[model samples]
Target: MLSEGQRIAGQYTVERYLGRGAFAEVYRVRHRFLGRQAMKVFKHVGSRAAAEELLEEAVLLSRIGHPNIVRVFDAGIAETPGGRSAFFTMEYVPAGNLEQYWAARGDRFTRIGEAVDLLIQICDGLAVAHGERPPIVHRDLTPQNVLVGFDDDGRPRVRVSDFGLAKRTDAFTGLASARGTLAFKSPEALRYRKGDSPAGDVWAVGAIAYLLLTDTLPFHDDSSPVAFFGVPRDAPPPSPQIRNPEVDDELARTVLHALEPNPARRAADAAELARLLRGWRNPETRQ
Candidate 1:
């Protein structure tokens, strides 16, 4: 817990506590020269090894430079009241996560065009990750990890954050280790315990698209203990049109295509998905 007036790493002066997560506590901080930024301080107190591990994540963030990915400014080991801690500063996103942004819009249905636009931005960011030499897979892709920022025109923009679960496709790891949140897992991912892949991320993008338009999960069911296991093998998920009639058939079909059970049948990658979304015809008045 950083105090409001405390300074760390010889530069950042804590302004206020922002929020806490399972592994870190975020704070709003002011740099002596860099102005305002968000500081993510690891919570594993007194563990030099833990701090070192977090430094690796910071390095990864720094390497993955994209307009839609949160930017890392600085990171290092810092002395704290509790002990030495690892902290990183990132570009602060003011509008909060996509989950909060969606909720703030109330129960009214989001415009289909607008929802697709947001998904396109997300895919654009992930495509950059996938475009890397070995390809980076953002295993965790959910509303909670998406930050809604704003453009110079005050229009809502989005950036992907929380890369703690990201992994390079070529890196050797346990087959099951590359998974993310259960609800966003692809059917094949859940069944085979496979780690991150382009197909897996494409599935997540489809799920997020479904969520934005319908305000519900694609495989919605509460009775089953395992969400993926409950998916009907005899039939595909209910079409987005079933939940929100306003969704165009082509748009619904495109999103559902990304959620195909077979990885081979899914969208090739985030770039492909983004291209598909970009093709949707504008429903409102044309420019």
Candidate 2:
């Protein structure tokens, strides 16, 4: 990890260590003129191939430039305690990630309408990637990957971050090798039956929505032996209303639809799920 106050490429100065994933360490940094940004430095280095792999996330982020997606500002090689490393800088979100946002609510569940609104924004961001000619599937879509902040007016804003495992799907089957968090992964993904696709992303969004509304995961056990054998096809996840009575039938149905074990039966992609969620009318405002 880069120490606090360390400067990189003579442009950004590390403000503090942010976090680390399997392959990279993140730091909050200050740009020479542009204020603060998040710098992700990959652990792997020393080879041309490794550098290319590290640059993939930056390239993908640059390609899919959207307000709902984290914006990439710069990418280059940097010196770290470990050695020379590949790194990229992006916008810094003060509020952290969706997981932290959810946890901040404490005992109270995120309001059903607010949860749905966040999911819509996430879907809108993913739609840009999925709408690509070959379609880019975000194999990983856990809450930790979704950054939550606020807009200029203080309204909640969410940006889909972390495209480390994202990939362009096959033109014909629209699938890529299955890889992501077990709890949020689709049934097909868990079993490696058909690989990851847009439908898989929908399942992830559904899982996040479920957690936000009910404060519980639809598929609770990520470490269960069942995960290795594949989630039981016969046993469906519990309804959201079972945990959160505030979740009306329409909202519950929408969440469940995205969790369908059969990808063919679920909403085709984030775009379709966004449409379904957009149709929901807030209970408090409905007169």
Candidate 3:
């Protein structure tokens, strides 16, 4: 909702509106001295206590600092045209998100090696959170939540972003509430059967990998009325190779294993998935 040129707390000047979700609006802003950064302003406007609650995402990102994770720089309450809004600033990646990157591939599927590499980087980032004392679960893991950019050497660099729904699991249950994009959610999460855990995050990673390889969701069927509710539970998703013949058995197995309907059968967590992906060679370099 912030217009370009607007200044927040006299520190960051809005460059442009990036996007918005259910509860927050993101803007590309320029820090007075620190160059460019992205600012996320929570929609809720209220007292200091409420603002503090909205700043949880910033706090969470600060604690889980990793090269594959977006970095939070600052957080505070800023006066907006609407009212006092809670805002946080983080590094801005110019190449946009994974969704855009995937879409740009158009009719062609992402290269097997490139897709696997990206997934591995994503897992690396999530692994840090999963390794936390109580274990943090990124309830929302979608292409839109992952930022894609280039490093100084021009190699693709991916960072897990949008931690708005991320939370540390309960010490006793090791579970967080079931909440995320339906297409990427685990069967257990969609049914509210076991809440959500590290396994649920792994499901999302698998879904993303499947999409990258096949250019379609693993279990999505637009024609089915049940699709609105969640993935069909009675049957497992088809292997990625079925849609894309280029997908080899080893890669297909790795992707399908992550999409297993049973959490117990899926890849243990992001760390395990990363390890599995490391074995695959980039298609362009495969001998």
- The global C-alpha lDDT for each of the candidates, from Candidate 1 onward, is 0.81, 0.88, 0.88
**Candidate 3 TM-score versus the reference:** 0.94
Q: Count the backbone clashes (under 3 Å) in each candidate.
A: 0, 0, 0
Task: Summarize candidate 3's per-residue lDDT along 88-146 as a digit string, tens digits.
Answer: 99999999999898777675554777888889999999999999989999999999999
Off by over 4 Å in 2: 282-287
Q: Per-residue lDDT for 205-253 in model 1, tens only?
A: 8989888888888776523566555345224578989989988878988
For each candidate in turn, give its C-alpha RMSD to the true structure in angstroms. Answer: 3.2, 2.3, 2.7
Error of 3 at 264 (Å): 0.7
Taking all chains together, each candidate's TM-score versus the true structure is 0.90, 0.95, 0.94
lDDT of 2: 0.88
Indicate which candidate wins on TM-score: 2
Q: Order the candidates by TM-score, highest first — what do you get?
A: 2, 3, 1
The Cα RMSD of model 1 versus the native structure comes to 3.2
Candidate 1: where are CA atoms >4 Å away?
46-49, 107-110, 171-176, 221-225, 228-235, 281-287
